[model samples]
Target: MMPRPPAPAARPRRMVSAFTGLDVCETAGLRLAPGAARVLFEQDRWVFAALIDAHRMVLDRELIWEFAEILNPCWRTVAKEILLALLAPQHEAVLECAHAIRSVRSPRTCFRFLQQFTDWFNWLTDQGVTRLDDVTQHMCERYLEERHWSVPVPGEPRRRLEPDTMAEVVRAMQLPVLYGELLSRDGCTEGFAPWEGKSASAVVGLKKGGPNRVPAVPDLVLQPLLATCLYLVNVVGPHVADLLDVVRAEADSGQDLPRVTKERVPAVREVLARLRAAGEPLPALSTDVVGRRVGRYGADPLTHLAWGRLARMAGASVFNEYAREQVLPEVQELAAEVGIERPWARQAALIAQADSGEQVPWTDPVGDEDLQLMANYVVTACLVLTSALSGMRTSELLELSVGCRQSRSVPGGGIRYGLAGRLIKGKRFGGVPDEWVVIEQVDRAVALAERLVRRPQGAPLFGSVGLSDRVKNLRGWLERTGNREHWGLPVIPQGPTSPRMLRRTLALSIAERPGGLLAAKIALKHISVATAEGYAARPGGSQRLFHAEMHAAEEEHHMKLTLQAFRDAQAGIMPAGPGARGLIDALRHVDAQLNEAARTDPKVLTDDRHLESLLRKLAKALHVGPANFCWFRDPSKALCLRLAGTPDATRPLVGLCDSARCPQATHHRSQRPVWIGTITTIDALLDSPRVAKGEKTRLVPERDRALRVVAEIDAAASTAPAGKD
Candidate 1:
């Protein structure tokens, strides 16, 4: 056995000088940044002690930086007085406060602890609390409830302080309970934990998912987004790569040069005008060039970058320069080429497509707007596709390096791509490297983005100027691609686009399907905070949590849906199936489990498991079709299938139904319209001279079935009494 080497001795502590370093500009053994000392001068002895301890013992740069940053804002304002007042009285209380927050070393943690603790101090003073011993469980509960802090947020004008932040504030407020463990016992009373389960913030509900709240991508938005990503990855991507090569060759031969000029003014101004009309704020140009501020709306980076560059070139030696060498012509042609043109009205003519804002791809001339627009849309598409599919958080999404794609063979067979990146949040120095197992669409999105940047290893995959810019670009893309008539609300709605939303949406979908939470764990990196301990990255535990969260969310959603179903039944607006009443009966039976409050809560019903199972069961019996529908999943369970002596595959075979006599074919108000419309279509076919006798024979029974459904609904609607529950 080898002998262990002697452990090195600890370094000597840095001693604070008189008047908190007022005499000397520096302290021996103190490796604190000078800025830290300047801020320390404004704080009291306890704060200085804490800061010095952080510098000498903790030696955490992030902690020191946070202290400096948090204190600096107060040094020049009324915040300074507020800070001084905290340290002026109850020296023992202040020291106890300092010691209590000592373990909180992260800059964000430190800043939050100090700031919130100071706020707590003021609250204590306001409530006539002169010392730590004065605090009670009631006081802590009162503080949590009456904190009354509100912050301004984008889209929302007045957002209240988050429950998580309030939770932290409450934790800091309760530190006095630690007594001897937290601070010296000389000023501490007979110690007791004042806050138990009574703190209001302690029981904060999981709602909005904190500051990272983002709504899932709506199915209306998702369909087009997926379509656009597919087009960009499969079609425009290859074309653009080839075009880039051509432009590169021209530049290499000295036949192409990047140019900016004033003649571009008309095109640039036109694009800018449209952008301004869309209510987006323009980016600033260099050298005192002012952008016309549009009314209240979000910011878009691609449009801003293009416009900022053009604005900078306004009077620069160009546009008005024909004396210059003819350059970048190939690049200009490439930009002029249309990679993708948008959305046609589904049932409208090709000309109406232009009327609906889609430009002609063949004969339509591509302008500067088209060039910039295409580039912006391409970037936006790649970002949306990659972020949504990969389940990477915003920082990870931003930090995504080019050439991040890795392909590996799956156990079964074939290959899958994993998008690799480093997780920066919650990490101190060296970030934890992680990857997401992605579908082929995500792989293509990354590849397309790589082609755009030539896959630079050092640069961000989807570079936006700022968080606002990232959000703006997302909002802009949604607006540009959306169908106005279909999507009634503004495409971006009123909130921010964040990575959490993408991760949540994917987790929710996976959990609801057969895959469940384990599937989510594999898909989402950093999904679980429980793994955040041990400094060993969980890779994607959040996905597991996300799965659990989605189940809760889904259960909540089903509760609402079930309530609506009860309303329909009570109002005599029954659904179009014999199973509808049975489903309602099952819900009532499930509701018997809840106490008096929940039994009649109008929203909540059976336990999550019971409720969710009921909903799925109902869905299986509630099959839908285009023209005629059937409410059955299995032949043995279905009356219509039993009479036919045929087993149902996955759904009811609507053509096999004898609707007039089929016990499973119950009609309601909504289905009556479909039945009526089907009857009209069949009548038109019957009236047609080109109809063959055999075809007419086939149509007769179907016509009779439609007639029967209409008669059935009419009979039900008329005979059924209308009332409220």
Candidate 2:
């Protein structure tokens, strides 16, 4: 029967040779261990483990890629040559590459870049083009135009490639020409340039300053998710910590039992006496374990006893047959006197306030498994809280470790909090050390995460689990535990969620407030000066997302002011200033358009879209000032521009503007309060006996001017048709 198993297969041996072509790893700035093999083609796999950092998100398998794994022989030949050139594009074997890719630091990134072209290589094979020189511009253009590079997946629905994905595909096409010179003689495409040298973005039809598509977490979803997370961290976290403490104590108290002797009876009886002295119930199986026992043994009462708990309490890992047989009746009597409580937890159940204003238990009685689940949920909660408040990228958040919380007292009084971590984006090899200045809540969240998981000083707090999945699981757990309903938390709406989305949400929210654009820039740690300025100069800057949100806020701000002006004019409260006539005329024109539209559809006057469209032009001309609104319809007529001697300036110079004298500026009742306050301040100063002669002269004219403006505002409001004032 044992016809002798076939002789064991021998392990394949790798052939090593003297280094020949080039030290591609050294050229790419990868440090290899001394005395390591440098041969390239002889070995199918090249290990770069020494070059990769432990904290890097890359997998261990990716450190040593197997070039031999590429099934297509022709594709494999070209891929290997292309990878070498990309690693050292400045080498003598490569032609002039003005936009040469900087050295690829991550092997995984390089691997993906080469792998992106497998489908295209197959297309080339089908066209009977075996050599790189045969890949012409026409073939490249056809590949892009027909989307031949995208292969259909088995179960995914067929859809057109996303613009970002397509952009990457176009880059893949250009690589053949970008590194073609470095290829072996037969693999070189000496004269061909992909798509005739046009940029990848241009080829993909991506417009400059196009709308940003990064999804910000919706407020409805974020608000509830954050509320629940905060509750978990502050309210329920202590109880969870207590439960974990019990588990740890039990685990650390090893199960090595003392040798059994006559003293066992006295020890067991003494433990029972102590338990009875205290009002505590006997330790028993959790409800879940009881259910499991009932399921297995047909609901027999004897199957539900927690013998292991009693044995552990009696200075033994488990009870022997002698103690069980002799002491079963006493144990039954003790169980009847004081009911059994769950062995895993001794803390009181947490109370949660329901939406209907009723107090309820946060969860059902928890078993060991349930306690572990709660611990995991608490970790997810901490992650959500940190990400929502810190405005850090996913990679940066994942880079956080135990004891990363940093704090220092400020000069004045309050303490500033920060998290020390490494930045993965735009860094070479191991990420550069960086720190995020955060609020107190974020600092506490990081601390809680550390406490939940017992990691050493530098051990990573969060894993590489998909953040989207974590959020989904968090919401599911909250729902299943009735925490959402009982705690009065809003239902988190369904949507795409990631750390990037959370970061964008914080940026978008901050970008909408006063002086928040600069605050958002600082909060997001956009440290590059060029990146800050590129919003005005370059279309696709690093701050494009922030720029887009800020620009939208600006547009919304102008529209709100213009709409208020229109509503005031409709109520006959005319603006009173040098530019009052011009402002009145503009409002009348917009009102006329609204009335004209309302003739056919009575609801047109009330429809937001209709009103917004009619007022958008007037809104564009409005420039809000500290004490006045500048209707800058004509830059040539702006007094501030004339005084500054900048005829071509698009925006008004608010510092130089004299609103009372400038024909483009207007003052409404809303602005009159500032003038009134100024008048009162000057009056109070003029009335002071310590007033100097020079101060008196300055104060008299200021008070008179303010009084005149106030009178005008008063007259306008009193004469308004609504006349409520």
RMSD of each: 14.6, 12.4
Which ranges in model 2 have alpha carbons more than 4 Å from their true place? 1-24, 31-42, 49-55, 90-99, 102-105, 122-129, 136-156, 255-308, 318-340, 344-365, 485-488, 514-725
lDDT of 1 by residue, 1-725 (tens): 99998543322221321123231113212233445534443343223333432311132343432223323232222222222223232333334333333221333344355666567666766676655555666776677777745655678765566776677766665444432332321122344454553453545553544433557765555544455455555555565554555444533554332334535545545544554455433332221111332223333322223332333333332233541223234223323342222111112222222124443232122223343344555666688777666566776676577888888775777765666776555553224666655666678788777876654585567865233355466556546544322223233444434567666666555433322232222332322221222123342543334445655655554355455554455566555445445454654664454335555667754455544554555444543333333445345666556767776555565556654554454455645666787889999999999999899999998988677667656655564474432
Top lDDT hit:
2
Candidate with best TM-score: 2
Tens digits of per-residue lDDT for model 2 on 1-725? 65876543322221321123556576555666677666354455667766645344767776776666655575665576666666655554443444557565366677676556676777777778876656667887787766733467898766677666777778887776665434443343444567778888888876667644677787667766777788778777767877787787785784576533355767777777777778566776765677788887776545556777777777777777787766677766777777677666464575665345455555555666667778888889889878877666777877888989888886777776767787777666677777666677677778878878877998889876477888888888778767677667667777777887876666655543322322221243322222234344434322354456656756776788788888888888878888989988988887787777778665524457778888898888887676788898899999999999998999898778888889998888888878988988888888898998799998898788888888877787777765544
lDDT of 2: 0.69
Off by over 4 Å in 1: 1-111, 114-147, 151-160, 175-200, 203-241, 248-377, 388-392, 395-400, 406-440, 457-460, 463-496, 502-550, 557-561, 575-715, 722-725
Clashes of 2: 0
lDDT (Cα, 0-100) at 410 in candidate 2: 63
Looking at model 2, residue 530 earns an lDDT score of 23
